[model samples]
Target: MADLGVKTPDVMTRVSEFMPEIITYIQTIIDNGFAYESNGSVYFAVSEFHEHPKHCYCKLVPSGMSNAELLAEGEGVLSGAADFVSEKRKPNDFALWKKSKEGEPSWNSPWGEGRPGWHIECSVMASDVFRRLGDPEGGMDIHSGGVDLKFPHHDNEMAQAEAESGSGQWVNYFGFKMSKSLKNFITIQGALEQNSARQIRLCFLLHKYNEPMDYGDSTMTHAITTESTFNTFFQNVKAVLRDAHQDDSAKWEGAETELGNAIDATKGRCHAALCDDFDTPAVMAELQKLIGSVNKYLETKAAKQEKPVVFVVKHAATYMTEIFKAFGLIGNGPEIGFPLGGAEGGAGKEETLTPVLDAVLEFRSAIREAARSKNFGDILSLCDKFRDDDLPELGVQLEDKAGSKGVWKLADPAELKRLKEQEAAEKARKAAEKAAAAAEKARKEAEAGIPPIDFMKALKLDDGNTPKYTAFGDDGIPTHGNVGEAPGEELNKNQKKKAAKEFAGQQKKYDKFVAKK
Candidate 1:
C-alpha cells in the first residue's frame, strides 16, 4: 500500500478483537424482533426485517432476497450442513451466529458455544468504531465491498445495523469488486512485479471505480503508452527550460497567448471532469491536449530560433504538476511529473547520481569537441563508446542531436541492456544472412563460367564415380553416354526432347560463358 501510494486508514480493527460487540449487536437485533434464536444458533429474521416499519431487508439488491443460490453462497461453506437449512425459519434467513462443530473455533454465547457469521462481524466492527468516535448513531454514509457481496453480505449488514439503531438507511452508497473465480485476480506484489505502481493505478483511474475493468493486454498497453507520453512531455519541457535564457527584451507573442489560453481551458475542463465523479479518462484527455499545446508552442519557438517565454511555460508546467500530484500520479516532492526510474527509490537514487552523470557527460562532450577539432576518428569513436556503451549500463541514455548537443535521461538499466543486446543480435543475424546470400551468388556465377564440355563432365552416374554422359549438346546439356555401355548411344526421342528443353533454358548463360572465355 505504501509503494502504491494508498493512504492508511485512521482506524484498523480486527473482527476477533470485537467479538463481544458482534455478540451484543446480534442480541440487540434479536431483542428488536428482527432476528431469532434457533436450536443452538441465531438467524436474521428476513421476513420480520422486511415487515419492520423503519428497516428494509436486502434494500441494496431486493431481487437477491429470494435468490437461493446467492443466499446459500453468502451463507458460506456451512450452508450445506445437515442442520443448516432446518435451523432457519425461512430460506432467505441468514446466520448471525453459527454453532461450532468439533475442532472448530468457538466462543461462549447466550445461544451456545458458537462463532459470529461472516456478514455480522463487519457491521458490528464498523458500528462499534463509529460509536467510540462519538458518532453514537453508528451509521455511515458509504459502505464498500465486492459486487458479489451486494446480494446478502451488504444487504445483511444494512439489515443488522438498521435493526440495531432503528435507522432507516445505514449506508448511502456501495463501492467496488474483483473476482477470483474468474481467474482475473492478481496479488499486489504480483502486479507490481509486472508493472510499476503508476501503470497499475492508471489502469484503475482510466475507468470508473464501480465499472468492471479488464486488466489484460490492451488495458496495460494503454497504461504504458499514457505514462510514456506524460514522461516524454515532461522531459521535453525540461530540455526547453535548460536551454532557455532570460530575455528582458522579449514581449508577449501570439504563441504565448495561445498556450496560456489552452492552459486555462484545460484547468477548467480537468476540474469539471474530476468533479463529475472523478471522470479521469476525460481528465487524461484534457491533460494530453494541454501537452500537445505546450509541445506546439515549444516547436514553434524552436523553429524560429527564438526562446519561449519562461514564465508562461513554467506556469503551465506548474499547474500540470499540481494536477498530477492531486491524482497521485506524481509524488509529493519538488520533482515535476512521474519519476522515470519508478515509484520506489527512484527520486532519491536519481538525486544521488545526477551530479556524477553530469560530470561524465561534460567530459565526454569535451572529448567530442577535441575530436572534431583535430579530425581524430578514433577519439570520436571513443566518445561514441561512452554514449552508446558505458552510460547505458548505469541506466543513462544519451541522444546526440544535430549540433553535437546530447541529452541524457535515466532509464531501466536491464531494459537498456536487453535492447542493446537485441540490436547487436539483429545486426549479426543480418550480417550472416548477407554473407550466405553473397556466397550463393558467387557459387552460381562460378557455375555459369564453366564451358558446356566441363559442365557435362561434372554430372556423375548413379555409381558415383563414372561420368553420367560422355558428350554434351551445344548449350552445356547432356546428350548421350552411360544410358548404354559405350559413349555413342543416342538418346531416345523423350530423352532428346528433355535435353533440348533443359539446354534452351541455359543457352543464354552458356553463350555468355563461352564469350567470356
Candidate 2:
C-alpha cells in the first residue's frame, strides 16, 4: 500500500481485539428485535429488519435478498451444513455469532462460545472507531468493500449497525470491491512485480471505481503510454523553463491567453468530474486535452522562432503538478514532475544524480564544441555515443534538438536501454534492407549491361553435330553458330523448332535490355 502511495489509516482494528464490542453489538441487535438466538447461535433477523419502519434491509441492493446462491456464498462454507441451516429462523437470516465447530476458534459471547460472524465484526470495529473519534451515534459517511459483499455481508453490517444504534441509516454511501476465490485476483505485491505503482494507479484512474475492469496487458500498456506521454510533456516544459528569460514585463498574449483559458477550463472540469462520483477517468481526459493545448501553444511559438511566455507555461505546468500530487502520482517533495525512479525513492535518486549529470553534460558540451570547431568527426561521434549509450545506462535521457544544447532528464535505465536496443535493432534492420536493395539494383544493372549474345558466348555449348563457325545479328540471339548450322539444321525438325523458340525468347529479353538502355 505504501508502494502504491496509499496512506496508513489512523486506526487499524482487529476482530480479536474487538471481540467484546462485537458481543455488545450483537446483544444490542437482539434486544432491538432485529436478531434472534437459536441453538446457542445468534442470527440477524433479515425479514424483521426489512419490515421495520425506520430502516430498510439491503438498501444498497435490495435484489440481493433474492439471490440465494450469493447469500449462501456470503454466509460461507458452513452455511450449507444441516445444523447451521437449522439454527437460522429464516434462510435470509445471517449469523451474528456461529456455534463453535470442531477445530474452529471460539469466543465467549452472550449467546455461546463461538466466534463473531464475518459481517458483525466489521460493524463492531467501525462503530467502535467512530465512537472513539467522537461520533456518538457511531455511523459512517461511507463504507467500502467488494461488490460481492453488497448482498449478505455489507447489508448485514448496515442492518446490525443501524439496529444497534437505533439509527435510520448507518452510512451515506457504499463502494468498491475485489476478490480471490474464483482464481481471478492479483495481490498488490504480484501486480507491483509487473508494473510500477503509478502505472497501476493510472490504470484504475482510467476506469470508474464501481465499474468492472480487466487488469491485463492492454490496460497496462495504455497506462504505460499515458505515463510516458505525461513524462515527455513535463520534460518539454522543464526544458522550456530551463532556457526561459524571467521578464516581469512579459504580458499575456495570443497563445498565452489561449493556454491560460485552457488551464482554467481544465481545472473547473477536473473538479466537477471528481465531485461527480470521483470520476477520475473524466478528469484524466480533461488533463490530456489541457496538455494537448499546452503542446500546441509551445509548437506555435517554436514555429515562429519565438520563446514561450514563461509565466504562462509555468502556470499550466504548476497546475498539472498540483493535480498529479493530489492524485498521488507525484509525491510530497520538491520534485516538480513525475519522478523518474517511479513511486519508489525517485525524487531522492534524481536529486543525488543531478550534480553528476551536470558535470557529464558540461564535459560533453565542451567536447562537442571542439569537434565542431576542428571538424573532428570521431570526437563528435564519441560525444553522441556518450549521450545515446552511456547516459541512458545511468538512467538519463539526452534528446538532441536543432539550435539547442539538447535536453536531458532522468528515466528508468532499464527501460531506456530496452528502447535504445529496439531503436538500434530497427536501424540495423533498415540498413540491412537498404544494403540488400542496393545489391539487387547493382545486380540488375550488371545483368542489363551484358548482351544476350555475349552471355551465350560465355557459355560452352558443345554438341558434336552443331556448327563450329559463329556470326552476329542486330538482335542479341545468334543467327549463325560456330558449326555453321542454320538455327538447328544439324539436328532433326523437332530440334529446329525448339531452337527457334529458344531464339525468340532470347530476342524478347534483348529487346527489353535495349529499351532500358
TM-score of each: 0.72, 0.72
Candidate 2 stretches with Cα past 4 Å from truth are 76-80, 178-184, 247-249, 340-385, 402-405, 412-517
Give a tens-digit lDDT track for model 2, residues 1-517: 9988897999988788988888888888898899899987898888888888898988878888888887778777544557767778788888888888778888777777888887888888999999998888799986766766677778888888999999998898766754545555788998887777888899988888867676776787788778878878888888888887666336778778888888899999999999999999998899889889989998998799888887878787788888889988877744467765545554686787786688688767878787778867668677787777677877878888888777878777766765566457669988999999999998766665565666554434576444432544565444455433455334345544554566566556667888977
| Runs of candidate 1 exceeding 4 Å displacement | 132-136, 181-183, 248-250, 340-389, 403-406, 410-517
For model 1, how many clashes?
Answer: 0
- Clash pairs, candidate 2, are 146-177, 467-482, 467-483, 467-484, 468-482, 468-483, 469-481, 469-482, 469-483
> In candidate 1, where is summed lDDT lowest over 10 consecutive residues?
337-346
Q: Report RMSD for candidate 2.
A: 14.8
10 residues in a row with least lDDT, candidate 2: 482-491
Query: After TM-score superposition, what is the CA distance of residue 410 in candidate 1 from its true location, in Å?
Result: 4.4
Backbone clash tally for model 2?
A: 9
